[model samples]
Target: MTTDPQVVALPMGDLTFPADGAIFPGQTVVVVAYAVRHAGGVFLFDTGFREAAPGDDPELREYFQKYALRTRSLPDVLAAAGVDLGEITAVANCHLHFDHSGQNALFPGVPIYVQPAELAAVREPDYTLPEVYDFEGARFEQVAGDHEVAPGIRIFATPGHSPGHQSLVVETPDGPVLLAGQAVYTRGEWAGIPGALVGSSDTRPGADQAGYARSVARLKALNPRRVLFGHDRQGWPD
Candidate 1:
C-alpha cells in the first residue's frame, strides 16, 4: 500500500548450502526475496522456497531433501509486508536454481522473467528437480540479455554463478539497488573472492572466471547504495 520507490527485503524460507568444497559447507542459508511497487503493481525478484519429490533416482531426492530443510510460503511474507498477491505483476529471478525458483507456483500465468541461457542450462541432466521449473500454468518470459522487466527495474546478464545468471537493478527512493543473486553468494565472499564468483579461471576449464569477475565487479562498480543476495540474510549498506 505504500508507494515510495523503495525495495523491501523479507524472509521467504531457508536452505542448506552444499558443504562439498564450498565455503559454507552444509550451512543453513536464509532464502530471501525482494519486492517493490511500481506502475500500480508489485514485482517479485524471486520466489522463496519449495521442496519436491525426486524426479529420477530416489536417492537424489534423499540428498536434495537434506538441502531443503524447511520452508515458509511466500504469500505469508508478502502479506506481512503489506503486499497483495493479486498486485504482483511479474516475477524475475537471479537464476532458476531450485531454491530460487521452487515457489514459481505462487503466481501462475504471471510473466516469469528468466535468462534464455539459464532455461537452456536447466534442461541439461541433473541441474535440479525439473518439476520446480516446469509447473502447470507456469509462464516464463525468456530474455537473452540485459532488458528492463519494469520501469526503473532492469535485469542484466551477469553469467558467472551460472551460465545464464542475471542480476536486478532497480531505482529506489534511497538510490539504485542491486539484487546480485549468487554472483556474490555471501558476505564473506562479498569481501573478495574471484574464484567464488566464476571458479578458478586459470585452473578450471570453461569456468568463465573472467565472465564471473566482470559480472561481480560490475555490480560493485555500479555502486548500488544497497545490495541484496539470494542466500545472505543481511544486505549491504544497512
Candidate 2:
C-alpha cells in the first residue's frame, strides 16, 4: 500500500522589508518552508534565507544588507519537525530567489529540483544569490515541466513571480495540499477576494502580470483542500 506522506510547515523566521514601492514596504512577513516525509525520504520545498557572515562576497553582503533578512536556524527548524539534516533526500525550490533558495548549499550531493528557466534566471545579474546554490557538491536537476517528485508529490510550472516558478501539490491523506510559493501572497489573493492587497506576483517586482493570473487560475482549478503560502503564516481553508 502506498501511504500518503506527512507534510509539516517549517517556520523559517521573518523578513522585514524596507520601503521599496512593493506591497510589503516596511512590513514584516513570515518565511516558511515545507517538509514532505515519505517512505522514500524527506523532500524539502523552499530553503529559507541565508544568514549574513563575515568575509562573504561583497555582492552577497550587499544583498543581505539590502533586505536586512533574518532567518531561523535550519537545523533547529528541521529538528523541531523530527527531521535531521542528513535525512533530507531531495530539494525542490519554487524559484531561486534569495529568500527561497538560500540554504540550498546545506544539502550537498542531494538532487535539487528546479525549473530550467528559473535556473537560467538566477544566473542573471541581481537575480539571486548565486553563491547560495552554486556550491561544492550542489546537484541541480532541472525539471522543465510537471514532474512527479515523489509518490503523491507533484510539482508543476506556475511561472509568474519568476520565469520558472512552480507550485507543489502534495496528496496528503486528508486531501490535496497546495504549496503556493509566492504565486499568490495570501489566501485573500488566492480566493480572488476583491481589494485583497498587492503582494503577489501580479504586483511584485519582476513579475509577469498575465502569467501570474493564469497560474493562479490553474491552481484554483486544482481545488486543493488546503492552500499554503511562502510568506503567510496562515493556511487556507481556515
Candidate 3:
C-alpha cells in the first residue's frame, strides 16, 4: 500500500453473445471498472457496475440476450476492493457506452470529466441511456483535449470507437501506464496485428477505421509500460 496503488481492475459485469452460433467459445466481455488510488484520493475511471447487470439498451438486450441490467452499488464494489467510495474524489469515462457509464449517477455533484464531443454524440438516439448521465445534480466537466486531472493522471483524447473516446495515462512508480479503453480493443491489437488500426488517415478524419488507427498510434507514441482495457480480462503479467 505504500506505493501509489496500481490501478485496480474491478470486474463489474459481463456482456456475452453467441460468437458464431456454432460450438466455438461464445464471445463474452467482462466490463472492468478501474480505481486509481492516489495520495489525494481514489480517482475512479469507469464506474458502471456497482453490482452486476446487462446493458439497458433495448437493441443490445434483444441481440445479446444475456446481461444483468444492474449490480449492487458502486460503493459496495469499492468497499469489496478495500476502497471507500466516500473517498472517491472524481470520476471519468473512456466513452459514453451504456456499460461504461451505467453507474455514474452514484456521484452527484462530483465533477465527472468527459469530452464535449462525446456529450454531443450521446444526445443522438440509441447512443446511450440518457438517464444514466442526465441525473439530478449531475455535473459534467467537459474537457476538449488531453488534460492532467490529477498529480500524475492525464486523460487524453483517443477518439475512434467513439468520437469522444478518451484514454487514461497514469504515471505510476513503475512507469507510464495507459488505460487503452476501447481505443485499443485487445492486447493483440496493441501487439500489432497486420490489419489492426495504427494511425489516422488524412482523407477521413473521424471515420471509424482511420480515427481508430490514429488513436492507437497516439497511445503507442507514449510508449506506456502497462496498458489496460475495459473488455479484456486476461492476466496482465505472466
Candidate 4:
C-alpha cells in the first residue's frame, strides 16, 4: 500500500447527446473510466454505460437511443486494460449517473464507494438507473466527503453536476493524477476557456453552479501533474 498507484484510462464508448444534453446539440462524446493499480490492488473510478436492452424503461431506452449510447462489456474492457475483475479491490464512482455507474452491478461484494447524497439522489424517481447501483449483491460504502479509499488513492467531493459527485486523486510517482468525473466536461473548461462545454452544471436542471465553480477552483488549486476527465478523451497538458 505504500507504493503509488498507476492510473490508466479505459475507453468505454461514445455517445451523441441531444440538443438538451451536456455538450452542444448533436455533439458526440467519448465516455471513459480509470483503473488505478497500486500495491494493495486495483481501484476503479466510474463504470461506464451499459448496453441498452429491450427491458429497460421505455423512457430510459428512448433516452439512450436518442443519445446514441454505445458501450462495451465492462469485463472485456477491464481485461483489455490488463486488469482482471478479481483483482479489483474496490470501486468508487464519481457519481451515480447512467453513464457513470451502469456496470456497477458487475462487481458484486466489492466495496463500491459513493457519497451519501448521491445515493439519495438515485431515489428521485428518474434520477438514474436504480438497478445499476442497488441490485442484489451490490455493496455500497457511503462516504460523506473526502476520504482515502486505498493507499495513495483518495476521492474528494466535487459536487455540482450531481449532489454527491466526487473526483479521484491518485498520488503517483510522477505527480498527482486527477480522475475528474464530469467535474469539468473537457480540457477547455479546465483551462477556463470561454464558450467551452461546462458539462451538466450549466445545463442540468437544478444544477448548483456556485458549488460547481467552487469545486473546480479547488481542483485547480491542487495543480495535478495530469488531469483526466470523465467524458474528454484527451488529458490536460497534451
- Which predicted model would earn the best lDDT? 4
> Relative to the true structure, how large is the alpha-carbon lDDT of every model?
0.75, 0.84, 0.74, 0.85
Better of 1 and 2 by lDDT: 2
Q: 102, model 2: CA deviation in Å?
A: 0.6
Please give, for residues 184-210, the per-residue lDDT of candidate 4 as tens digits: 889888877787677644656646788
Give per-candidate clash totals.
1, 0, 13, 0
TM-score: model 4 vs. ground truth: 0.93
- The digit string of per-residue lDDT tens for model 3 on 1-238 reads 5656568887776765355543113555567778998878888888764332364456645533544343436677778888887888899988887678878888888889999999998897756657655568888999998999998998989988788999999997778888877787656567765753322322233347777888888988987888888766642321
Q: How many steric overlaps does candidate 1 have? A: 1
**Collision count of model 4:** 0
Model 4 stretches astray by more than 4 angstroms:
20-23
Pairs of colliding residues, candidate 4: none
The full ranking of all candidates by TM-score, starting with the best, is 4, 2, 1, 3
TM-score of 2: 0.93
What is candidate 2's lDDT per residue for 139-160, written digit by digit as tens? Answer: 9998897899998999978988
lDDT by residue (tens digit), candidate 1, 1-238: 6554567786877777567724356667788888877875787888876655445457646756667558877788888989988889998877777778878887889999888888888887656666766688988999888898777888978987677888889887777888887777765566654434322232322236777888888888887888888777777755
Rank the models by lDDT, top first: 4, 2, 1, 3
- Candidate 2 whole-model C-alpha lDDT, 0 to 1: 0.84
